[model samples]
Target: MTATAVQRFYRYHAYVYDFTRWTILRGRGQAVEQLKLRPDAQVLEVGCGTGLNFSQLLARLDPRRGWLTGLDFSEDMLARARRRVAAHGWSNVSLVCADAARMDLGRRFDGILFAYSLTMIPDWLAALERARTHLEPGGRMVVLDFGRFERWGPLGALARGWLRLNHVETRRPYVETMGSLFDRVEVHGRLGGYWFTAVGSNT
Candidate 1:
């Protein structure tokens, strides 16, 4: 989908995004837990829609010392993220509006996360490459997203079609790509392989 289309798609969905996504957007908390963030770690969350992962990220990283940057292409999504940051009075969190595939923050980070975002990015490989460049040596990159269903049945077919309608392409080889880019890669399939979590290390 085009950038305009993506923005338009989230314009109104931003309001109900967190409420509805919590049920189906699984593995997010597990991904955050696997990050093993340092107290003063510098973390970047690409495609951080409405800052849904911010609270978990903050709980892991020390608020007074660590820094969390949330980046998204949709203005409407970021608006809610801004409100979340303000309402929480989180001084360490920052939000950026930019394309995940092409943004230079001018510094490397200790941890990078992509939460159910790669499927929506047409140039996901480019985004992953860029993320690798922005990771400090020995840094970790985490990915949690939809994957192929383990079962082949009507329900699986319907699920796949519904995801495609939402512009999510779950057929992409996310684990393979991460393995090729990082020194060490670990992956876990969950919900009967309907979702997956991948962790890649720059070491």
Candidate 2:
């Protein structure tokens, strides 16, 4: 999809996004926990829809010693996210409405996350590469999204079909592309084996 189309689609859905979809989604907290950030590390979350996972991340980082930044292409989404940040009274957080594929935060992050956001991006590979570029040395990128179901049976088809209906398309080439940039990649699945979480580190 073109950037305009993507932005429009998300803008229309931003308000109801969390309420409509949070139940089905899984692995976000696990992905955050696996980042293994030090107290002083800086973190960024691309496509931080509604900032649903911000509280989880905050628990892992000390406010006085750590910082967090969230970037998204949709202004509507950023607005809602900012509201959540304000309600939570967090001062160490920042939000930017920008294309993750071309964002220049002017500093590298100790960790980054792409939670349930890659499938919606038209140029996801470019965004992943940008995530790599934004990382400090030894930094890790934690990704959680729908994955191709390798299990056999009629249920797998049903699951894939359900995701397709929502405009979600999981790509397996992500592993190959990530392997080229990251020294180590670990992938795991959850939720009756339909969802996946991947952690890639610069090493």
How would you encode candidate 2's per-residue C-alpha lDDT over 91-177 as one tens digit per residue?
A: 999998889778787889999999888877778888998889999988999888887776737877777777765667664477677
Which one wins on TM-score? 1
Report, for all candidates in order, the number of backbone clashes. Answer: 0, 0
Model 1 lDDT per residue over 1-203, tens place: 77677788899889899899988998888999888899999999999999989999999888788999999999999999999999999999988898988988899999999999899988899899999999999889999999888675678878988998888888888899999999899999887778899999964
Model 1 alpha-carbon drift over 4 Å, by segment: none
Worst 10 residues of 2 by lDDT: 163-172
Candidate 1 local Cα displacement, residue 21, angstroms: 0.9
Which portions of model 2 show Cα errors greater than 4 Å?
none
**How many steric clashes does model 1 contain?**
0
RMSD per prediction, one decimal?
A: 1.0, 1.6
Residue 73's lDDT within candidate 1 is 94
